[model samples]
Target: MSWMEDLLLLGIGGIAVSVYGVVAGLLLLGIDRKLVARMQARIGPPIRQPFVDVQKLFTKQNIVPEHAVAWLFNGAPVVALVSSLVILLYLPIGSIPPVLSGYGDLILIMYLLTIPALALVAGGFSSGSPYATVGAQREMVTMISYELPLAIVFIAIAWRMSADGIGDPFSLVTIMQYPLWGLVGPLGLIGGLILLFILLLVTPAELSRIPFDTPEAETELAGGLLVEYSGKNLAMFYTAQGVKTLVMASILIALFLPWNPSGLLGLGGILAAGIDIAFFLLKLVVVVFASVTLVRAMVARFRITQVVGMYWLFLGLMGIIALILLGIDAIGGA
Candidate 1:
């Protein structure tokens, strides 16, 4: 195919991935709510609750606060949702390659991950609400806090791959091809597990979910960063939240659990792809449950100070130790 034809095909693939991301993200959110409720012994909304909420939200009128910077306030949610969708296009489904493979890598995705959060901060500050302003500040701080350990997790894995002579160590496709577990020996395996745990801890913060959800502490900030958003604008942010959750889980799968049962069972063709995709979704569910739902259910919101310490101090130290172990493992192997 010519370049124009290839571009058109990619556009079609991008659309398909966007739709899948939104639907799957919302579904995962609904499941999370239901699971959390069950843990608390209370009945929860159905698995379609997020979908219903989005539908209702779009029908309601969008109210831009009179004092708000109308353009920035109105634009933030669109940016957030669109950026979240773009991140999904670069992440592969089970047996499928990413829609825009070779054009992007994990580092680009890491940077892309921040755009939605920055958009939220911009939206909140533009709203001109004290609560939102505070929320935006907290969101900015949270992003800063998580960066060290998050980068450590990425660099450790990619470096290990590089030591193993894996080409394109920064590529998600390469990570999937030689999962860290298979490449690592005993100490590296422990280090890899530690990195996975650290990433799981970061997932909640990345999505602004509980414990780390200081930015949207509804109790204290009265919806916090989103205090002034309503109707369609709110819906887009809500959907973006779900998509970000899905994106985080998908990244975790690519890193830690990229195995396919089909290959082990000698399956082929459509059957292999079907089974692999099914297995991948199952991993997403597990990752989401462990990282987001379970953690949120078990913990109260952390103070902003505590949030910083947890990520930068505690997780950061752990991440450093993990990197050291991986280094030792590399030397020992050599």
Candidate 2:
């Protein structure tokens, strides 16, 4: 294609993915709230409540603290939202290849995943409130804690693929094409299941949901990292949270459940694409429920120390065991 055509395609694809990310992310948040309410035997907000909240927030005043770094405080939300959207461009949605698949891979996606949280940390510290500073520190601790198991999950799968002589094992497309499950033996299957469980647990921490939301403990820190944020700035953070949820679930789906309904049904063309997209959305809901809704409903928030210990000590050990099991399976198969 010509340079002009390439630019046009990039623009079009970027817009499409952005729209899908925002809409679907908010929808998932709404669904999650409704499900949690139902589980607790309480009436829930409408599925469109999140949209209403965002709209209301946009109309409110945006206040910058006199002591805060105004530029960083205001710019953080945009950075967070934009970085989250960028992940979708590298991720395969349904049966569609990523818009920029040739340009990046899973490792790049992993790095992009940290950008939003880092932005949040920057925003928190910039707020200049003691509470916000503490929250920022906690957020950094959470990020560092969960990263080990997350990295292990990626390495374990990629190692198994490379062991089987697959090139580009770290590529999202390659992993989706040859799912980790199909490459493993019975032992490795069990190991993969363990890793999958760890990844699901990581999802809540990545999104700062309940049980892992120490950085945003409303009761203690009075909104914590976002204590000084209001109006449009707060709304941006809210939308970014929703988008991050979608990004995490999408990555989980791509890594573990990359199957499409169209392929199973032996269909093709636009009809297949439609069915596959619907199926993909369904998978996203399942992931959100299993990883976020259900887990949050069952547990109370953990202390920051507890969060660090849980991720680095407990979950980290489990991930190592899973990797070892996969390694043994690889050797046995060879």
Candidate 3:
């Protein structure tokens, strides 16, 4: 294709992926709510509750606090939503290579993963409320806490692949093509499992879901980072939250469970692609339920100090152990 044709295709694909991210994100959030309610033996909100909630938020007045940096407060939501959606463009969804596969890789995706949280921190600090400021600090702390284990997980996998002679080990396509599970021995399998567990634990914190939601503790902080937001601004944050959930789940799927139904079933053509996409959605729901909904429903919020301790000390040590095991496995294999 010519440069113009490639650009046109890219634009069209980008639009399609954006629309899918928004709709799927909201749908997954609704599903999460409904599932959590059922798990508690109560009638839940409809699966469309998120959509209704966003619509209602949009109808309300978007108030800018008199003490706030209005531009940063307002712009933060856009940044969060856009950055979360951009993650999808770089991730391989089911049988489809990432829309921008060649343009970026897993390293870029890791960096992108932090952008939404940073946006939340920006919004909170810019809001100028004491509660918002505290929340912003907690959000930054949470980001710092989880990043070590998260990076270790990525490095462990990529390093394992590189040891096995794969080029571009950090590439999402390369990682997907040679799943860590297939490349490892018995010890490496155990290490990979540990890394997967660490990543799964990181997911709730990364998305700021409960037990890990210190930044948005409604009871104490009164909505915390979002205390001052309302109307369209709040709506954007809500949508961004959903998108972030989807992005995190997608990342977990791409890393730990990159399997596709079509290949297993010996399917071909559009039908295979359709089945694979459906299967991918199923995987997303499962990951979200396990990492987000179930954890939120089962655990109470942790104190900020405890949150920091758990991630930085416990999870960080566990991630180091996993990486060490992988290193040993690589040496043994060699």
Ranking by lDDT: 2, 1, 3
- The residue ranges of model 2 lying beyond 4 angstroms of the native Cα positions read none
- List per-prediction Cα lDDT, in the order shown: 0.94, 0.95, 0.93
Q: Which parts of model 3 are misplaced by more than 4 Å?
A: none
Q: Work out the TM-score per prediction.
A: 0.99, 0.99, 0.98
**Candidate 2, 248-310: lDDT as tens digits:** 999999999999989779999999999999999999999999999999999999999999999
Candidate 3 lDDT: 0.93
TM-score (C-alpha) between model 2 and the true structure: 0.99
Residue 233's C-alpha lDDT in candidate 2? 93
Error of 1 at 252 (Å): 0.6
Judged by whole-model lDDT over C-alpha atoms, candidate 1 comes out at 0.94
lDDT of 2: 0.95
Q: Show pairs that collide, candidate 3.
A: none
